[model samples]
Target: MAKRIGITGNIMADQSGPFPGYNRAYVNNDYIQSAAEAGGVPFILPVIQETELLKEQVSQVDGIILSGGQDIDPLLYGEEPLQALRKTFPDRDAYEKELIQTAIAMEKPILAICRGMHMLNVTFGGTLYQDLSHASFAEIKHDQEKDPPLKTHHVSFEKGTRLHSLFGDSARVNSFHHQIIKETASTFKAAAYAKDGVIEAIERTGELFVVGVQWHPEMLTKKHEDMKKLFSLFMDAVGT
Candidate 1:
């Protein structure tokens, strides 16, 4: 049986059609393709405001993938605005927060990426650097500014960590995030770090299948088998 993977979708402006007032819910094809390649049935989960509807979706999906998007609202983590802070989506934040909480409570596997990683941290009472400039290791070259972004750095995983188990001790991965996980949630353990000591990956401390990575593994999966392994590992946790 194929496991159902519920992926969070992003809300973006789409005013080029006859109906020009409404924003559209979208998920990158990379996320969908990656999940499918991992042997799971991928589906977009719109930001449903109805609590019961959201719960119903969560109950059906075997796992959740919090797809990458805009910055998280600092207010969610009880912080004031920083000049370096980027645009945030409050409605998406609220929806995903509730979704994450429900998923964790039910012990469902979660794989959070990029902005989703930051959201996961905040949801668990942890905090994040509003921007890379505010982080302790601000010197790290985390913001890979290229026309079409490419892998530029290697992340060294802690030996024996689940991430290390998937990609060995160190593996080259694409970098595209500015914000870094400053203080991980109490329930999660920092599993990987970059050369400049930025937190690159984290996993739940206990047996719960929760993992978050700061890089764009979905993009790398097309060429790098190791990156694809991360998705495969998540599927294994989902236990199809």
Candidate 2:
């Protein structure tokens, strides 16, 4: 049987529609398509406030993909909001926090991307830069204005990491995140780094297949074999 992959969704209020001010739960089609093409049944896990329902949502999926979204609330990591901090949704934060905790407790594999990577770090007691400028060493243009499928920068993989096994020492990837990981979780290791020294990827220290990438592979999977293989790696970890 194919594995069931749950992709976490974002909530947005309808603007100027018949149901104006009404909220909708949605995950980008790229995520669903990437998961399905990677040989897993994809399901969009909507953002909900109910803890029990969130737990049940996680319990049903063979693995979880924490899809990218808004900036994380600075208060989540014990800091006040910075000037460059973008919009944040605390309710979504609450929902995903529960999802991460429940999924880890359940030993489900996780593939966290962009803002999802930020949430994963914060959930594990790590912190973020709030914005790229906050980190002086972040000289590279992480927030690329080019098309989503284009590779904008290069990241060097740490030797012996799963990423290194896939892309060797260095790989070019699409960049689209403003916030960057400030301190990785104690239980996780920085797996890849940009030429300017910003962390590009992270993975749990132990063998649980919990990995996070700063880039959006879902957007590149259609054009890049390496990006597609990243999803395949996650599915392999999920097992049958």
Candidate 3:
């Protein structure tokens, strides 16, 4: 039997299309493709506020992928939104929060990407920079705008960490977000860090198979062998 992987989908409002007044749930195809490539059956779990339904969905899946999307509301982590902060999804945040909590309680393996990573950090009692500019460290352009994404920075993984085991000490990955984990939760260990001190990767401390990355590995899996291996490793955990 293939491992059932539930990937979180974002809610999008179609303004000009035929469904102008309707909202649709969607997830990036790259995530589904990567899950399939890793030998898992991918399914997009819609964002809904109903806890019972979210719990049911979590119970059915062997693993979960918190796909990237809008920024988390700053108020979530006890901070006011920065003046420059834009685009937030409270509904998605609420849905994913409950879903991930339920999934964790069920001990389901989880892989969080980009904003997904931010959610993990917050859900675990951590905080975020709100905006990269708020960080006092040396600045790096995190929001990379290109025709197609490009690797813009190198992340060094700590020895003996899961990230190090997966991608060695250092590897370059694409950057496409402005918010980052300011402080990791007590349950997670910062596994990788960029040169300017931005957290690049994190892993759960004990037995739980929870890993989050600030970069979009799903987009790079087609071109980067390491990203492919990372997804394979994630699936291996899920299959277990």
lDDT, candidates in the order shown: 0.88, 0.93, 0.89
lDDT of 3 by residue, 1-240 (tens): 879999999888788977796888889899999999989999999988877888899989999999999989988899988887879989888888888789989999999999999999998799998788788894888877773346788999999887898888899999898888888999999999999999988999887789999999999988888999999989888957
Instruction: Score residue 52 of candidate 2 by CA lDDT.
Output: 85
228 Cα displacement, candidate 1 (Å): 1.1
- Model 2, runs deviating above 4 Å: none
Q: What is the TM-score of each candidate against the true structure?
A: 0.96, 0.98, 0.97
lDDT of 2 at 202: 92
- Give me the overall lDDT of model 3: 0.89
- Pairs that clash in candidate 1: none
What are the clash counts of all predictions, listed in order? 0, 0, 0
* lDDT per residue (tens digit) for residues 146-205 in model 2: 799999999999998888898899999999989999988898899999999999999887
Error of 1 at 197 (Å): 1.0
**Candidate 1 Cα misplacement greater than 4 A, ranges:** 147-149
Candidate 3 shows a clash count of 0
- Candidate 3 all-Cα RMSD: 1.1
